[model samples]
Target: MYDVGTRKQALALVSQGLSLNSVSRQTGVSRAAIRSWRTRLEPLSPRSEPCPRCSETPRDPDDPPAYAYLLGLYLGDGCISPAPRGVYFLRVACSDAWPGLIDACAEAMRSARPDNKVFRVPRQGCQNVTCHSKHWPCLFPQHGPGKKHEREIALEPWQQRIVEAHPWDFVKGLIHSDGCRITNWTTRIIGGERKRYEYPRYFFTNKSDDIRALFTDTLDRLGVEWTHCTRAGKPYNISVARRASVALMDAHVGPKY
Candidate 1:
């Protein structure tokens, strides 16, 4: 075998496209030695450093890297006001993508304007448990005693209102309920009923922010401008009757009410 110098030259020649055996012969080095030298010269990239903030990279299927970044806002002052108030949308349990979901909701809340704090609700369920924020648990508590397989259940007062108030204005537009007769809401739009032109309806939780998107869309469809109101006071009947009575007097008399 040739000395180290010849082996190095042989490897250089092979790298330049000279045949391995040809390189060995020209440089007086063995083909095997040239092969070994060539392998050693291959470039290597720098090793990556671990992320500094988190000890472990989150591995839950629902927690995408993007969501982790978004959720970071909640841990900071950007979204966490001293005593924030709003109708925040929250997922109920630790199901699929709980972390990512929380991240997204937290991001939306942080971005909301100061005066409009009531428009969103901070979601809750598992306190520190890693969970998907998207599929939030029911906003209202269970009606009856807690059990694995409960037989019957009832709606909360607000939940009942959402069901009973055939049609409601979210302040943005009409918010309604929908479910098969077998489900609830005490009505059906089946065969014979289909003939009637029914008003549009939708389901929303006590949390108004959760249904903000629905409110925005409904207003667009009805060609009406609306503002989001988080509180629910007395029913719309009182307001509707007063407006109607004022209109009746104005038409009969002057423009005065």
Candidate 2:
């Protein structure tokens, strides 16, 4: 028999959109066993009503701007854990250097569920915006084990609707968390004279190919062009260096803060 922890891990993997075969291979469990666990642990049907006090009058899942932005942030650097009783806790980790982002995350949580208390927990080099809400798992069913690259990160149909409505906000949240805007410079000799020109660009780095695909898809929808490259011994990157593409991103995502 699988331990409770293993069962939970397997359920989480299934929640993250992993196929039965993939979960079985990763967990060294038989596909039949994983399938049975999924049937037993996951809800057989979607709940008709939101959890009481957890997300009473839950925010509209289709609202694109703020909620989608927050969802992006959550998917990038957030986690959900079991709290006291049966409640779930949601926490989004932000670097100390970006106070705006920290505040934004806190505000977003409050906006999503006004009754829930949102606060920050300070660590060595980062601060986490945390709150106790029973609806966290409902809000972010994407919660799972390990890094995003290790699992499939696909959005549900409802989430896809929100993202389709506010692709820019989604991009904004994504870039603010896992991407950066910077300046690039190159020097060349023209007419026996050295000249240097600088240009602005955006770089988004992530280990998850699915997440990267989502980012690129949004860029594509916005008519922005980008290129893929990799840093030595680092994650893959999608770079937007062309003037037009940078301008487009600037209009949508802008600077981190």
Candidate 3:
């Protein structure tokens, strides 16, 4: 960030008919900065935007819990796509089965990028919840080319910190997307009498090994036990069926309505 005095000096040098390269050499400012100063410098550049992730001494997002939740939603089922301008769109498909989840996703998008507008585009079986922001990549480093399952998805240190602080919100966000709670019942003989026992459990299914690891890691932090279930020759399911673990999940991330 150059000061006014520096800008004035650079402009003065330019007024003297000095080349941008020469001025940059003398003023120690980038050639781009000196070139932009030729027209006007008061407004600075869009780079001055207060993006927490891009700021010097970068910090967490303004709403850490929302960010953590949004990250979960992104890693679980969200996507970032390029737009017409330099901005990119962050979208998550919310099933029509859960209108409340759609609303919650919109709220999280709003909280994550308060200045950006959130939209819900209807589809055959779901609502595409999305928002446009140039900083989406900065916020979600896990975004990349091709399918997420085919590539690695790892969080930055800062994101891990946020998830650690708001494990429940993160877990709930993932559950809202790729996880669910269901009750499985079976008949058993207790004291020679037929009885029905219902097991309430959570199932988080994702094709990405890294993402599943992230979910299970958070569950571990929350003292919730999870087991891997391989089916169809693939290990893509995480189950929380233990009584205590299911209770913990119920207390934090219950059935999605």
Best by TM-score: 3
**Model 3: which ten-residue window has the lowest total lDDT?**
40-49
Give Cα-based local distance difference scores for all models: 0.31, 0.78, 0.85
Q: Which of 2 and 3 is the better model by TM-score?
A: 3
**Which stretches of model 2 miss by more than 4 angstroms?**
1-59, 233-235
lDDT of 1 by residue, 1-257 (tens): 46756664564454333587777678777777766665563422232222222226522212233222222222211121111111123221221224453444434323321122112222243222121111112222331233312223333454334323311222211211111011122356777584433222222222223233333443344343433334465111111112343343223221100
What is the C-alpha lDDT profile of model 2 across 1-257, one tens digit per residue?
Answer: 88877876775665544578888889888888877765563443344345432454544543357778888888778888874445677888899988988888888877666665676877789887887666877777787777768999898777787888899888888887888999999999999999998899999888888988999998899898999887895548999998988998887778766
Candidate 1 residue-wise lDDT at 33: 72
* Model 3 lDDT tens row, 1-257: 89989987886565444578988999899999877766552432334346788778888899998888888889888999874446678989899999888988999989888876677777789888878778999999888899999998898999999999999999999999998899999999999999999889899999999999999999888889889999798989999999999988888778877
lDDT of 2: 0.78
Models sorted by TM-score, best on top: 3, 2, 1
Q: Give each prediction's root-mean-square deviation over alpha carbons.
A: 22.7, 11.4, 12.8
TM-score of 2: 0.74
Q: How well does candidate 3 match the true structure in TM-score terms? A: 0.80
What is the lDDT for 11 in model 2?
56
Compute each candidate's TM-score over C-alphas. Answer: 0.18, 0.74, 0.80
Which has the higher lDDT value, candidate number 2 or candidate number 3?
3
Clash number by candidate, in order = 18, 0, 0
